[model samples]
Target: EHKRTNMNEAIVEKLHGTLSILRRERDEVHRAKELAMERLRLAKEETERMERTLQASKQKYDALMAQSTNNSNSNSNNNCSNGSDGHGGKVNESVEIMQLKKEVERIGREAKFQHMEYVSKRDTLAKLKNHLKAEDAQRSKNIRIAQETLKKRRAKLANIQALARNHISTDGTSGGSASRGRANDNGNDSGISGGAGKGKNRTSASASAS
Candidate 1:
């Protein structure tokens, strides 16, 4: 009731306009989202199509390779009939023998390389062992040298400590003896002065009496 009487008409009109603008924005956002989803779906379909094409190409390549191998085999067995009469068993046997020869050569090469690698590794291991032994020997020698040096240093320190202690004791005894001697000399001087003072006083009294 209060809003009906007090509210401005222009403000109400402005609010209605703002609501309409907001509704348009909401619809635009929904359309943009739908477009994005559609693009995503199309991208997925394209990826699937590319994958299928790749598979077909791979199959075609395999077929070509197999056909080329068969042709090579057929050409190599020339003594056999040009057609399939004598070429049948001979072509298959030749292909098998060639495959076996290639496999055997590959195996032999691998074995040779493995043997060489083993020898190299063995030599390297031996060298490493020698190096480790040399290092151990040097470390032991250094340890012995360090121990001898430490022993000499300890002996020198002990001698220096003994000398310092003797010097300190001698200084303490000399100081005590000097102090006692000074005290005795001061007592003797005071006694002599007191005797002279008494003799003078006695002589002065005799003169006065006479």
Candidate 2:
């Protein structure tokens, strides 16, 4: 009984230790999950800021394009007026218009490049968001698995405790029966010894009488 009790106590202690370790692991996983969520939030904010910047750039590009078109119309009117002045003025006007056209083309190219860059950045931000989402999902899955595992461990611990209780109870109930059986055996042995002793005395008496 003492040995069995010691064994059960050892097992319970070991299980409690394991439960503590598992709790620590669960806490760490929860912390990781919080960190991941924070990162996702920051990523979303950054993407929003980028989108706003891209929108502003697009608006600026559109305004510049409109101004360039207006400038082209104005230059055309000036050329028409200066055409009658002389070959020199016409040549100078044409050069000025060519320079203006070049400037407009350069601005258009810059706007196109800027738009492409914006698109690339947007795509990259989208991918980042997706990646963060996946990470969040994976973290959630890990937490759920951990929780399930913890539940199972608790259930196992409960079963171990129940079995231990049953074992102790059975030993307690049978203890009296075992003790009674031992006592009866001792009594039988004593009676047999006494009867043998009496038989020896009787033989001695008959021998003396003879």
Q: Which candidate is the best by TM-score?
A: 1
Off by over 4 Å in 2: 84-210
Question: Can you tell me which runs of candidate 1 are displaced by over 4 Å?
Answer: 1-90, 206-210
For model 1, how does the per-residue alpha-carbon lDDT over 1-210 read when each residue is reduced to its tens digit? Answer: 233323333344454555465456556655655565565555555555555555555565556557656776666665465553445665675666666556555555555555555556556555655665565566556555655655665565556666767878999999999999999999998999999999999999999999
Q: What TM-score does prediction 1 earn?
A: 0.49
User: For residues 1-210, what per-residue lDDT tens digits would candidate 2 score against the true structure?
Assistant: 455556656665665666566566656656765665566566556555655655565565566567656666766787798873244644665565566556556655655565565556556656765766676666667656656665666666666677878988999889988999999999999999999999999999999999
Residue 50 C-alpha lDDT in model 2? 56
For model 1, what is the alpha-carbon lDDT of residue 127? Answer: 64
Error of 2 at 113 (Å): 15
The number of the candidate with the highest lDDT is 2
Using all chains and alpha carbons, the TM-scores for the candidates as numbered come to: 0.49, 0.43
Q: Model 2 — TM-score against the truth?
A: 0.43
lDDT of 2 at 106: 63
